[model samples]
Each structure stands twice: as structure tokens, then as C-alpha cells.
Target: MKSTEPVCQYELKAARDAMEVIQGKWRIPIVISLTYGTKRFGEIHRDIPDISPKMLSQELKALEENKLITRTLHDSMPVTVEYALTPLGMSLRELLDELRNWGKHFRGEIVGK
Candidate 1:
């Protein structure tokens, strides 16, 4: 057997790790919406009405832990929080664009819609 596994295990693991960061029902939408600019919890929720509040919060925390998004707290009355993409997250724009294009093409080819 001439190595049935990946040439580099770390690289394979890294790719899987990256996918996990954005893998979910709401993570990609959350990331795409943030491209418009920083937004508060409610603003994000409004932008993606299909996602429930708890799911959104969970995705936000995952993105934050992955260093993909940053959360800021405002010291005003009642305290408001906002989320923005980190440099790593912003750098994903090109990749995201390509993925979006590919998805459209794939859907069109398959569904003819």
C-alpha cells in the first residue's frame, strides 16, 4: 500500500477545521450579511429572519472562537453589542465570491432555474 491517506495529515485536518468554522445552517449567511458592515444582534437577526435567536447566538460564538468575527460592547444604557468580521474573515471575501458563483452555476445546471 503506497500511502492511502493524504500526503500531509495536518493539511487535511486544517481544511476540515476551516469548513467546520463556517459549516451550519446560519454561519454562512451570518458571514455574508456582515460583509455589508458591522451589525448588532437584532440587526443581524432582522437581516436573516429565518434563523432563530438561539441559533444565531450560537453561530456568532463559534465564529468568534474561530477568530472569524469580533464582538464589541457599547457602554450605553442597556448595553448594546455589535459584530464585525476580523481580517481573517474579511480575507474570505474572494473565496466566498467564488463559492457563490459556483453555487449558482451548479443550481442552474441541476435545476434549470
Candidate 2:
């Protein structure tokens, strides 16, 4: 038996780039949390307590660079910053939802949960 499929180099590179953007340990969770609403750096840290500040900062920077998230600075008595999904990032919610459903389906089979 053999597989019959057409492979395009551009498609392959796009897939790899997409994976690279979301490949960090904390990226997915961070994205999921922010999907609900905008969050301050501290709020994101609290939501994902296992992630260190350094790691979270790094992940947020990477996501920003990938155009998946937007960082906004607010001017006030004291400066504040918030993170939110960009239009491009919001577009990924549907895909994430499907992935979540797939995980739910596989969890019991794989972990007896």
C-alpha cells in the first residue's frame, strides 16, 4: 500500500512556522487564558502558575513577534500593560476548540481518566 498525495513546499514551511509559533510549553495555555479576555502580565502569571516570569515573558514576546498577540501599554498614575489576542490569533480559537475536543476524546483512552 502507498499513499497518494501532493506535497507543496510552501504548505510544509507554513505548517512548520505555525508549529514553531505555538511550540513552547506555556504558549498554548497562555493563549487559552487570554482567549477569554485581556490579561495583565501578573494575571497571566497567576493563571499559569507553573510558568516562571522569565519563561512567560519569553513566550509572550515570541507570540507578539509571530503576530498572534498584541501588547498594549496604558498610561495612568502608574503604567500598566495588557495582553490580548490579535485578529489573527482570535482566528485560531476554532482550531483550538477542535483540538480540545480531540484531547477530551483521547484522554480517557490514553490515560484511563
| Global Cα RMSD, each model | 3.2, 2.1
Query: What is the TM-score (0 to 1) of candidate 1?
Result: 0.85
List candidate 2 segments past 4 Å from native: 1-11
Please state the error at residue 7 of candidate 2 in Å: 4.9
**Model 2, span 1-113: residue lDDT tens:** 89878899899999897787779678889999999899999999989999989999999998999899999999976899999999999988887898799999899789994
What is the C-alpha local distance difference test score of each model? 0.91, 0.91
For residues 1-113, write the lDDT of model 1, one tens digit per residue: 67676478888899898788778778889999999999999999999999989989999998999899999999999999999999999988987898899999999999995
Q: What's model 2's overall lDDT?
A: 0.91
- Collision pairs in model 2: none
Candidate 2, residue 67: how far the Cα is off, in Å: 1.0
RMSD of model 1, in Å?
A: 3.2
TM-score on alpha carbons, each prediction: 0.85, 0.86
